[model samples]
Target: MLVNIELENAEDFVFIKQLLEKIKGVKSVCVKEEEEFYEDGTPKWFIDKLADYADSLEEKDMISKKDFFKFIDEEICRLNSQK
Candidate 1:
């Protein structure tokens, strides 16, 4: 049987994997790290939506990539602070 476990800390993976491997019926254990959508931790879906919104904008309303990233960073910081 394949079981998926989510760990709170990456450091705990090796310890957990070892423990699972000792179980009698276990076959093999595989480790897969969590996938990252973007380097800045932005979700791919959100980026796609942003791209669609930008595409719909008029030429004069479009913003530079640097400014766009600055806005995204600020938004992320603001959202994280609220939590």
Candidate 2:
């Protein structure tokens, strides 16, 4: 199967990478570099943090608010402006 995760930090990604090595039926568990989130914020490490939380909350196939908001807000604004 395919397990996608949003890690909270580089360290978390490292942990997942290592864990995957010892697991099975994982197919390919990867953490992709998400686009920047906060439009006018400190550019927090939100995506990494979200991924980290995912690793901790294994078996939960969902994105966390920590990083999802960034992309959502941007998309919303882009759509609204077009309308």
Candidate 3:
């Protein structure tokens, strides 16, 4: 079984985690900090920097989305061929 927990106070995380770990049937405890993301499950930082990335690509004469997709497709095919 797996469980996800959201704590009200960050300071209580360590104490709560230790308490849970002592339970007889508890196999393991993992901690993951919350992250902000878009509805599409994209990280907020990645989405925020996309425009900057696109602008840099455009400066290098790679302005078209079609060109980007084609490049990615070719790379995937090449990698698959190598395998």
Candidate 4:
């Protein structure tokens, strides 16, 4: 049999977990915090934070996509040549 308990407060959850641990046949108790995720499987909060960071970078000085790709390609070529 499986049991599910929901507690709004962290302290209450911890106390109940301890009490449940003493009971026989209660093999394992797992606790997980709920998180929202985007459709692409990325955490929504993290993606929002990344968007904010990118906006900040753009406000200062942003590199062109062409230049960025060129730099990456050159770096990859250089590294491959070293092998």
- By TM-score, who's the top model here? 4
Expressed as tens digits, the lDDT of each residue in 1-83 for candidate 3 is 78889988999989988999999899988877687998999988897799788767745574589988999999999999998
Q: List the candidates' TM-scores in order.
A: 0.41, 0.35, 0.43, 0.55
Off by over 4 Å in 4: 1-16, 19-32
Q: How far out, in Å, is residue 52 in model 1?
A: 18
38-83: candidate 1 lDDT, tens digit per residue = 9888978788999999889998997999999999999999999999
Please name the candidate that would achieve the greatest lDDT relative to the true structure: 1
Q: Model 2: per-residue lDDT, tens digit, 1-83?
A: 55567666777777778888778665665655676657776345876787788778754566778769988999999999999
True lDDT of residue 36, candidate 3: 92
> After best superposition, candidate 1 residue 1: deviation in angstroms?
1.9
For residue 59, what is the lDDT in candidate 1?
A: 80
Per-prediction RMSD in angstroms? 11.5, 18.0, 6.5, 7.4
Poorest lDDT segment (10 consecutive residues) of candidate 1: 31-40
Quick one: ranking by TM-score, best first?
A: 4, 3, 1, 2
